[model samples]
Target: MNSAEKIIDRFGGQSALAGLIGKRQSTVGYWAKKGTVPVSWHGKLLEIAKNQAIDLQPVDFIPIDDEKNLLPAESSLPKATHWGELTIGEKEIPCYVLNTGDRVFSLKGVVVGLMGTDGGQLVEYLKVRALQPHLPSDLLPAENGEIPALFKFDTGGEGFTKYAVGIKIERFNELLRAYSSALLDHHLSAHDSTKIALTDRQLQIATTAVRFLQASSDVGLVALVDEATGYQYERAEDALRIKLKLYLEEDMRKWEKTFPDPLWNEFGRLTNWKGSVHHRPKYWGKLVMELIYGYLDADVAKWLKENAPKPIRGQSYHQWLSGQYGLKKLTEHIWMVIGMASACQTMPELRQRMAERYGRTQVQMTLYLPVQH
Candidate 1:
């Protein structure tokens, strides 16, 4: 019996094997006709077969071929020990993008989340048509004993060798962008369903979350921001001041000058205080709240310009702020945004790190002083 015969007999029939792979019997027969399993079904087929406790080998595809191609072979593929994920559409496809000196990876599982019947077809779609070269290279198979011995597709074959995948580090980002773009075209995306109200820094937080997913990096967004901002309140105030210049400078005149003064004053040029001369002694928290709200207004405006749908973007500040989910609510969300950003200065991973290090989930500053009125 031939390799096809062996597979069919082992699994009952071509129809049974095809059923196991969620493919038509004709597709299974085509594999038998070509005397080779298509690469797309390689991972899934192997996975399902293993789950059924069937140990498959490469010779099953090339039963008539000579013995030389059956042995373990060497190939220079990257050493990718770190596992990561690339989320597309709604599914998060697990992958690895590691760089060990010159080599990148052996990609057998990259297509697990893609829309291909095999890895070869998916590679063709990405590299040939999409013009994305950073995708895994079609290197010959690396045996289970090789340096990059991680080839999940090599099971057992009879040709010179099956081709494996390797991606260059330089092209990793490009690969992600292309893969993400393709996913967006094929499936509904988060961007399409949600409003974009995050400021650039806040957007950085989102992107950092995504980047963390991509490489499964050990660090968190808040930690990375802390390294950049030194976890200082003054730095956060300065950054928020820059944000205010973009969207809320004029509305800010409602508060008196020298009330708290400009949060950041880089220039020594004398600009007269232009705030209203209202005569009410105020609580310090009220003044801080006003600045926080103004900053949020600007931050939301910028986020809307880039992420929100057209009608929302066109609304004036009053109209936008007056909506059902207006200032009072936005104030809280925005507070979380800036507060989270500020907290990053001291707590990189924030809640998790805090919980672990200090044995706490919340913190507060309480001043105990006798008040004489």
Candidate 2:
């Protein structure tokens, strides 16, 4: 194992280290890619290690730089001395984050620049409201000439140093956005939810799916299940979208109005088929979850064949289950089979895994299939 991996292992695993750094486990792995640690991250890792009772030093991560050519070209660039500047709408804000989730905005220089003329007055009002009278750590302390008074942020990273405070990776962009918005009105904006970055294909699939939702006054299980189907395969997003939309067209023909907020905004983000290396069809995937519940030639499929659906056009029960109904019935059977499977095991293992993955165990779970169509 490389030094980075070794450090991560000592903290239990990648996930533990990720939790400490307030980053995704995958993003943290990037720092340790190919058994090489990024020079920029060397100091950060050492500090984290020290906090965890593990001994690590700067030299343990990189060469001593006695000779210039020994290091890679990219490593020589000036490292980010602090948590770094965050860009929001072409405006850069100097900010600091602490392990305690406190964010200290550096209002020394840009106070007037960002807030216009009355920026200082607005900041003064926020100083008392977002006040942190007691200093939590030296990382983001209020310098004498700083803004009205330093305030603790609602969110931040898990480490802090004298010069800089670390901000959580997922929260960095959001903090910048909220801070900028707050300066305008002197009050924090609404919280921003983490959004998944989608590719072109995923965006198309989501966009097309929203149209179907928009066209329907009320939707059934099939329509909902169709949202995430066929996203498991690479390059199949558009094909699946086309097939599902055509199949559900007649069902959605009743209403031609646009989609509600949840369909367009919420489901659009959820249904993004971000099938890249960092993200895969692990969870929230109707097809993959179907397999986990034995939807493919297994108990759930057998149950679905025997119990769910009505025959159509003289086709076999299975053959009749096509398109939207097929997806809908498949989804219904998945939940039922999951319940039955858990019942048989007394399922200490499954229950524990469920609690770990989703905060709730089988006993605590409830299913509502929308009373069918």
Candidate 3:
């Protein structure tokens, strides 16, 4: 009998073969007509058929001659190793920017906490898009051009939004300043050497924000903050959203110069005395929170303790004091903000990104602090 006849005899023909393949007779006929298995997995299909205990048919047979006891030929096409291709919208530009000195951070806490997705998804995302060269080759310099930092994205969950971005940090010092400022902003305290009132949201964002502090030989503070916040913050004519950042040198200096300053002069310079103002800038909040609480918590704190006052502090000019400790709190809060800036590029990401990032550690300080008599 010919191959057709062999098929007919094997599994009692087309109808029986359909049951063996777990497909309709029509599908079997269609595959036969198509003259091949769906794609390159033809070997798997045949193995499955044999496993099902279906009587082998001549037509289903693959001619692998045992002449030299050789194995099947290997494939040339790239194997599907990673989680497939990373496709951002064609129109969407994946490139983000950072200044001279900026820090990179993690979004693990906020991303996993709020988004309900672990670092796996984020890792996959980074493997594809972020790992690729998004920045223009000419733009990246030979020596000090490429910014040192990390990038990430968060597709929000538990009532949150989705967004992505890249960030770069110059050194640990920059990270500390930003984190400290963020912490100060979050506590809603004006008792620093400098006196100022921060809005509730500002305080939250400043305190809890997570960030990455890229450690390297490079110097300069540059953070590339991006998100899906549209162009509202740019004051665009047709912007769909609006982002506002307030920079207050006067406020920073006033607080920094307050009596019994616990912060070093450089700390004061970094936080309060800077000539420029970056007081506040609106961003996609959801993404920001994720990056902060999710990503950079450990590094930021580690750097803070190292650079912040030592021997803790007690209470007077003769010894350690409240203002000094307050300075530490303020530093953490600001650092949180800097982290938030990297993570948060949109408003929705801001809400919880700020809350959780700040909320996590804020309770410890506020609740446990010794009251001044």
Candidate 4:
């Protein structure tokens, strides 16, 4: 077997390869990719041979000699050497280190910044927080009263050190639970036992569906942050805004394919087809949620009412959401509106808010605010 494959097999193959390399796994990975070990580690490999119960011979693996066939250049930027103090907005948060290069911080805002320190304090902080059940392995401490500190860690690779912290979305979770439960029961019943009239139930179902759709969009936004900022929520949001815009433009292509001439009458309701027997069915809820989640806030809705084509003035919320508003418009609106709401600032606060705001019903308002600056 090749040297990298041999080292890989020594730890029971690929499944356990990561554990064998310890904190320096990426370094070994780099060497393996290049098909050579640094000249300095050759003797150490031989010494480790006895303890690892593996044969070690210089000839067994290719010598570090060839330059022409070396792997693509990679940064030797030392793994983040320092983790600055845990700062959520303006506050210096209490944090714990989890390993040699993992740390946890607490935050609940959609906007956050990742700062580096001179030593490995971030990872040390994560280790400390991991000892407690309330803290997430990927969360840092935020609000003390509602959120009891959390844990989180960054998975570093691709030439950049990474960090991540999970912000609990209990309101969205409850919405999902309510949705799943309603679907299973085949009825829309609030926990408080309010007798929802038949028409009200239908409206509730549609509204909840739209909210969930928005939540799905929110998930995409978070993922965008993860990719762009690499353990920093602050940069992630900036990148997310850009990514969302691209997603909208792409979605427009899909819309053109799906509905070539989705006609709306003067009232903003689909009225271009005949009766049910010769009907052109419209997807109202899906379209509305996409708009509200993507761009149409209260003010935007008001502006549309004032300036939209006169025929569209009376259209419903769902009708408006599904129209031309895509990622670009939504990003613009989110940047403007996200700061208005004040809600939970940490995970525990999120859970608490969920119970207080939505415990008796299947729906509630959720605000995403950044850590206080």
Candidate 5:
């Protein structure tokens, strides 16, 4: 028998278990039908099991293979191999890495961290009509009206079993996207009841979703997960090599005026250069190397410096960057540098700003000064 069925039988059948737990008999039946118990009821059941002298272990609550209509007696389920917490602002969520390489956050952590509500409430919210459209297809209720199956893991310790229920990292992003979309729809259709219904806690969740979406892209989220779980250190050494391949071109592109004139104009103003901004001093290249390119991964900067074709006259280092990902990142970095330069009144102020933003040690001002000829 599956875990849920065994538990029900131990409590002297579904009706007796329902009476002991103050839940409807159908609810107990549903648990048996799903081959797993809702985690919210675990504590009450465990306590009752203790009082009744029934043999109940935390591992008894691990979900069975409902897909095959069989117990996991012959084959073991996957377990968590790593654990960590992801902190965003003041809130922290417990995260895990399965032996299968899936990254997940506990369902309780997601709801409490993002929504400030009980995890069960989020499950209920997902069942509502307003959220169904925004939810991923896999997360939607079955056509027979059964709740979607949770992706449970064996957390490898009794204390950790309470946190075994989790959603994958990709699903977490999708959940955030859904919350964001629903919130947008609610705001746009304030008068329409058919749109998303936002309770105070759900509004909080939607706000968190908006902030998360604003701050991170798919790639940024992956890196955040890696950093949180310390998986970045365990990653294959070729990870950097693969990333560099994406950011650097194998061959130089046709030279274009990548750096805008405003960047140079602001640089001249901040540095107190008396020379014409149109004919920038050669030291401008050194400044670009330090402030702009220096913001990239140290190895990326080194690779660019050592391998890129030496700038021939009007050509520049940026021409060596791949047009797709590299140029996009470079453009964003350049604009941020220009913004910093525009904010500062003098060269030292600019240097301080760059140092603060990029975590660079203060450098000698003369390093960027023109030759005093």
Candidate 6:
């Protein structure tokens, strides 16, 4: 192992080191990538090491001569220009965009984050899992038992140099899919005697994989990384405006029955409204704002509230939504609300379900807004 790996291990892994030093796990990952901790952090790290009963020496931070010889001169390695954490549940995998525009994840971070296992075990896991007939043929390991090559990158600061291992973001995602598939297969075949028993760590990995795969596509993952690092704002100043345009129309469309009858029926049932569902109580408007629109992207929902036409004598807020993407999103959100309403027996129960499913929106909605004259 290199100095960086040794230091990380002695400190009880990347996450533990990060917690000890009062820094983000991604920052510790950054140090690991650079193959050395910053001088400023050295004192704190040593102090933490001593308290933790770790045998960390100051010289351990320096790269060994043999390791240096193995690496190409510093000039050959690409420099990271942008970097951020890809948070999946409690785990955060440090990711970076090179000056060359190539995106990659910290090699050790990816292994530790997804597998909750040792970074050194990744290659061997891939080799074993790749040979499984149940796994995809396109998995990371080759038929000859070779794994994908690790990328080296420079993450040095002024007047100093450091290097760390990385895997291309695409390869990282591929590994996630492979591991997810393997774990899921194991989960499904619980009765098989030949299969190794699933550990708690593997179960956690499986849960994380399902959540990540459900929410993020390859493009979405890139966008998430950009958002986390503030690179998206740098890339496009009007990104929110552009996104709002997709979810709101410049002009109101012809009024239609955008909301289904069952939605109001359920609302009426829950609220115990004696009046007809067709002529919903004025309070229903507030519920719509809270339950339906609240589920949207917070900024998009805010833009709609401020800019979209208010409910006039004849038209409602849904009528002002764009016919294409905006209406599609509205319809989807309505069904989700209706689904929750259908499942709950009481108002508090429905609210609890909503909180569990969507959480509370950060933007507060006014309960009563004057209808436009």
Candidate closest to the true structure, highest TM-score: 6
lDDT-better candidate, 2 vs 6: 6
TM-scores of all candidate predictions against the true structure = 0.29, 0.18, 0.16, 0.20, 0.41, 0.43
What is the C-alpha lDDT profile of model 1 across 233-323, one tens digit per residue?
A: 4344333323322221122212223122222120011112234324223442343443344344444444323433223355554444443
Per-residue lDDT over 7-101 for candidate 4, one digit per residue giving the tens place of the 0 to 100 score: 55655654454555453567766656755454334445655666787765433332222333322322421222323222222223223343444
Ranking by TM-score: 6, 5, 1, 4, 2, 3
Q: TM-score of predicted model 1?
A: 0.29
Q: List pairs with backbone clashes in candidate 6.
A: none
Candidate 6, residue 31: Cα displacement in angstroms equals 12
**Candidate that would win on lDDT:** 5
lDDT of 2 by residue, 1-373 (tens): 6545665677778788789878898876875674445443544676788887886543343212223333234333223322444322123335545444444443421332233321233334223322222112321234453332332231222232112112333332232333333333222223432322333432332343334333221323433554678424423323333333333333321111111122222222434544542334444334233334332423223333344333235443333333332244443434544554344333344435444543443455778777766
Off by over 4 Å in 3: 1-165, 169-176, 185-189, 210-373
lDDT of each: 0.40, 0.38, 0.32, 0.37, 0.66, 0.63
Report the C-alpha displacement of residue 82, candidate 6, in angstroms: 1.6
In model 2, the worst 10-residue window by lDDT is: 252-261
Q: What's the CA error at residue 349 for candidate 4, in Å?
A: 52
Candidate 6 C-alpha lDDT tens digits along 49-156:
888788865445544334445367767779888665554433445667899888987766666656664345466656553224444444456666555467577754
**Which tens-of-lDDT digit does each residue in 1-373 have in candidate 3?**
3323344345666687677667788866654554323322233444655886755421232122222322222222111111111111111111222132222222232223212332233333222221123223322223533333433322111122222333332322343345345454434444554334444543432332221112211111212221244323542231111010111000112222222322222222333344422232223233333433244333333333344332433334423322232233434554555555445544445445666754544343445777899
lDDT of 4 at 113: 20
Number of colliding residue pairs in model 5: 0
- lDDT by residue (77-112, candidate 5, tens digit) is 567777655544333466778889988876666766
Which is the winner by lDDT between candidate 4 and candidate 6? 6
lDDT of 4 at 186: 36
* Prediction 2 TM-score vs. true: 0.18
